[model samples]
Target: MAKISTTLLAATALIALAGCAKKRPAVLPPAPAEQATEVAPSGSAGDVDPNGGPGSDADFRRSVQSNTVNFGVDVYDIDSTARAILDSQVEWLARYPQVRITVEGHCDERGTREYNLALGDRRANAAKNYLVARGVAASRISTISYGKERPLALGSDEEAYAQNRRAVTVIIGR
Candidate 1:
């Protein structure tokens, strides 16, 4: 029984390693099952367009093209596509000055928790700083690092890892 269990563990580890070795696209879409967008409490305010625009985060999410951005395996830098998305977010934020948001930094199940946490911070700040530089209020934005805690894809494959490594802008108090 001991030998059997050892063999099984070895096989599982080998399969996981093989999956990560496979080549994959640079940028893959977020997991189909994972809905990445989130909204904050609107308080007693009804779901009306207080900003004369999209009333709720849901409406705002639908109005824009994409809500989340992807990152490289261990990278947190924002690419061109990410920049465009942030531009849109800045526009939305500017429209809704009353809104506040939190940029969540995430990572794939690779690297140590400490390392990933630091990397995740860089990722979140990368996005937040871009927005602030573009004129979004720094006070309204905040950051958090969830380092591999919240994975969109539940596998050891590169594709799964790619999906997992991302930065999500969640509406905290809109």
Candidate 2:
């Protein structure tokens, strides 16, 4: 009876030890390699130009309306390059006869909220001015500044901050 009890205790310990062992993930067969990664449009991913040049006027219009332009880099103090990009953006706006746009200005998370708001306002105004200059009609182009309240990227690095500091062009109406 004593021998049988000892054997049972040893078997139980072995069972527990086996149960505690780390189980490995099931390995599946290797998948076939593809020649290239296919680009597909989703919520965050914008459409890519298959032709590889600046897309067509129609495509540009779609892109502008879809919030594709990032005019937020602080690298430009003169702001002419930003203006020129916006000029092109407004040109794209002309294609959609009834569509109106709202330029939402943003800033990097480096500054105070109030200061960032002011900076963002300036950025939006710059975009608005360019659109107005290009004959987009002042009424059609409204401006708003989110400041640093809404950052596109959360990281503290320059690359992330650069992307966060942008004025996005949004299509408000048909």
Candidate 3:
């Protein structure tokens, strides 16, 4: 018992001496916050956000009223439902001037390639024009026709066709 007590006293004295030694400043000061260092809407993975919006592609879609509007087969006209969606989009745009978008016109797999491309162009333009008319800056919006190349749903049935015939509003930048 006496040996154990002596050993413990030495260990405690050594620990005390070790604690008295000075330590170098191991931590650096935090980097200064800079707005310029913030992520831009270059479509990089980091820029997109949900709260301030104009975020990443998915977050931007969720931030907006509607990211897609469907159309009837072979039609480029904007229906009432389509109009409402565009209206919501316009409202969202008004709130976020930094945001820019690309309207992608897609078609079902039923039409000829050339025909589908034409239809997609018309559809994309229709949505773009609607936004322009509703106070969205024309310069902030661009249109592209994917035609039947990119299908949201893959099948020969009407359900898949309907799902494929849509104009997708993509967030291009902030």
* Maximum-TM-score candidate: 1
Off by over 4 Å in 2: 1-81
Model 3 spans with C-alpha error above 4 angstroms: 1-56
TM-score (all chains, Cα) for each model: 0.69, 0.57, 0.69
lDDT of prediction 3: 0.79
Q: Highest lDDT among the candidates is held by which one? A: 3
In the range 1-174, model 2's lDDT, one tens digit per residue, is 999999999999999999989676434222212213233353323433333322332355555443434554553232665666676676666655455566778898988777878888888787777678778889877777777777789999989888887777755443
Judged by lDDT against the true structure, how good is candidate 2? 0.64
lDDT, candidate 3, 118-164, per-residue tens: 89999999999999988998998988887887789999999999999
Q: Is candidate 2 or candidate 3 better by TM-score?
A: 3
Q: Model 1 over residues 1-174: C-alpha lDDT tens digits?
A: 999999999999999999999666334334323534333355544333433336446655866657788999778888999999988888877777767778888899999777888888899999999989999989989888878777889999999999888888866554
Q: What is the lDDT of every predicted structure here?
A: 0.78, 0.64, 0.79
Pairs that collide in candidate 2 are: 72-165, 72-166
Between prediction 1 and prediction 2, which has the larger lDDT? Answer: 1
